[model samples]
Target: MCEEATVSLADVVQEDEQLQEEASAVLAGSDSERCSYPQGYVKRQALYACNTCTPKGGQAAGVCLACSYKCHEGHQLFELYTKRNFRCDCGNGKFADAPCKLFHAKDDVNGLNKYSHNFFGEYCTCRRPYPDPEDQEDDEMIQCVLCEDWLHGRHLGCDVPDHVESWEMICEACMNTHAFLWRYAARLAGKRRENVLRDLTDPPASDPVPGAAVESDAAKETTADETDGATEPSRKRVCPEEAEAKPGCGLEALQNAGAERPGSGAVFWPPGWRSRLCRCDACQASLAAAGLSFLPDESDTVLAYEKKGRSEEGGAPGHDPLMSALDNLSRVQQLEIIHGYNDMKSELKDFLQGFVAEGKVVTSADIRQFFERQQSRKRRRADDRFHCA
Candidate 1:
């Protein structure tokens, strides 16, 4: 191999381990041997969409991890990572020719489940397929917590914050739909532009505009500079203090206070922002009415789901399969095996690179053929050495 083409064994091993951990994080919460249909509207699970069964522009459908393995083995599938409140749609009339082998009986449709362009392998406002063949930009995609749609960071209509895993995002479409969320957004939003938001939240004190609204105690305490060197006369307000003491009082105060909503853009909320949501009866009712009762649930976040997956898998970084196989071998056999592995790695990788670069699926037969070719090459080299001797 050329110098540029050569890769370090440690680098290859590290990359392989990283890929295994990522796969485990995604699939740990799922069962590949049994159908999840019996679970009934699972809170969260890894899901797949079969392109062969539910083609683009047709009725969108998603299958659970087990169904993807058992029922749609040879079909082209799109890995959707994870989805919330989803029921597997493997054989429930969506697949014209295929019936789920694992779960034969299922409702015709999961009425509560929602489908999006992502199910059809399209994502972002650009509506491009993930790993797009035409596009070369390797921008990261962020999933909206509300709509569960993946969008490219640049198309999110706002700057994506650093340490993205530390925060959650609600896309612009969801933000507009759930405009009531903006009322609580002041506490969490615009951390990057706190000065701008502060200007809006705390105005400069001028000759008191007659009958100016009383500021809520929930508002940030103003600094001397914020007051512009003039102490405004304290105006008594009924809900100002109560807003902090009562669970839903802040939401109520915002409604009554007629505070202007924040400008349009995606909102990034810090961890535990859910705990800050008002849980009072009226707020709960409003949340339920809007089908967002899950907002207050910390478990609904993708990070939480991935954490659950990791935990279920014993939270191990990974186990080296080759090392495990070598454990029972003698020292001489182990050395021989390691030598064979070193020889196989480069040749096998070069052979597979053609299939990967061409975006072709490598079948079991292809793997078997590669091994047979390697054995043949080894035998020929042995015969040549014997003849020279």
Candidate 2:
């Protein structure tokens, strides 16, 4: 059995806040409009800083690279230069209201946040940032369609162990898309398709394993160009009630979709999509019984309608309608959670990137180990603080 992880109150609040803020960002368009991105994504700059936040120290501007994600999340931030020598402004000047939330060592190792930082200026075989007038080459650097980062011909695809064997690369930001899609496709006709996926990262094996649906992140990524990540949905987002009304979520409908088609007898919808795309009460109960969670539909149409509905109708005043549940969701399950269980999975995945990104035999043990590692990290961090103090 998978290590059981459940949701708690704190998790719900955090996710609610995040969802509301994201909704606000989408509806009102915060500083996001002025934000410059790597085509479809955002690139970090050492000089980038957010003027928001209630100056913890006395600082309002000049935020440092180390404290950006923590200090500037959901804020309108701007970028300046690429100075490498400038020190972090986290605890100095008007910013001294409190210690840096990211790094506890105020003086050691320059107190920086490197965990999520993208430390790249340029990429490709040429090794220069894009639009270099000095190079004058028409051949361009490969820009990843997922993360939108420019990549070197050899160093593309994923960051650590990602299969970097192709120019049409889909970065890690969207690697999960293919995993979920594979699962859906496998159950499409209620049959497991053998070797439906091929690994793009590794050289071809003479006699590969038969019926292998998952290859690796690199293999899953071959389907990324046509698929969308959790944040980017290609279909209309509907309520859970709406989803059950369709096929897949309901067992009978699922069987119907899988029923034999005489030269395409029935127009079958993709399997598991009913649950994957719904957020209604009925779908919530169904997924709960199956030990799964709701991955809310985030299509623009859905977001817009929700924003409008919330504005006009308001939330359940006294009921506090149960807002779905998620545990150690299958990686192939695209339901993105916000806190506790949702966040626990993310933290664990971050810790065990190597394990999570391995070839497609991700088992319940893999999921259990992921959670165990998270507990170990937390305990280790607490121990270090006690020893240092």
Maximum-lDDT candidate? 1
Model 1 score (lDDT)? 0.74
Candidate lDDT (C-alpha), each = 0.74, 0.37
The per-candidate count of clashes, in order, stands at 0, 14
Please give the range of 10 consecutive residues that has the lowest summed lDDT in model 1.
207-216
Candidate 1 per-residue lDDT over residues 301-367, each given as its tens digit: 7776766777778754666689789988899999988888877998888887777666566667999
What would the TM-scores of all predictions be? 0.68, 0.24
Deviation (Å) of 84 in candidate 1:
0.4
lDDT of 2 at 293: 38
Which pairs of residues collide in model 1?
none
Give lDDT tens digits, candidate 2, residues 2-101: 9766554345546998887554433332122222211211122234444454322322344454355565667655443232223455444434454556
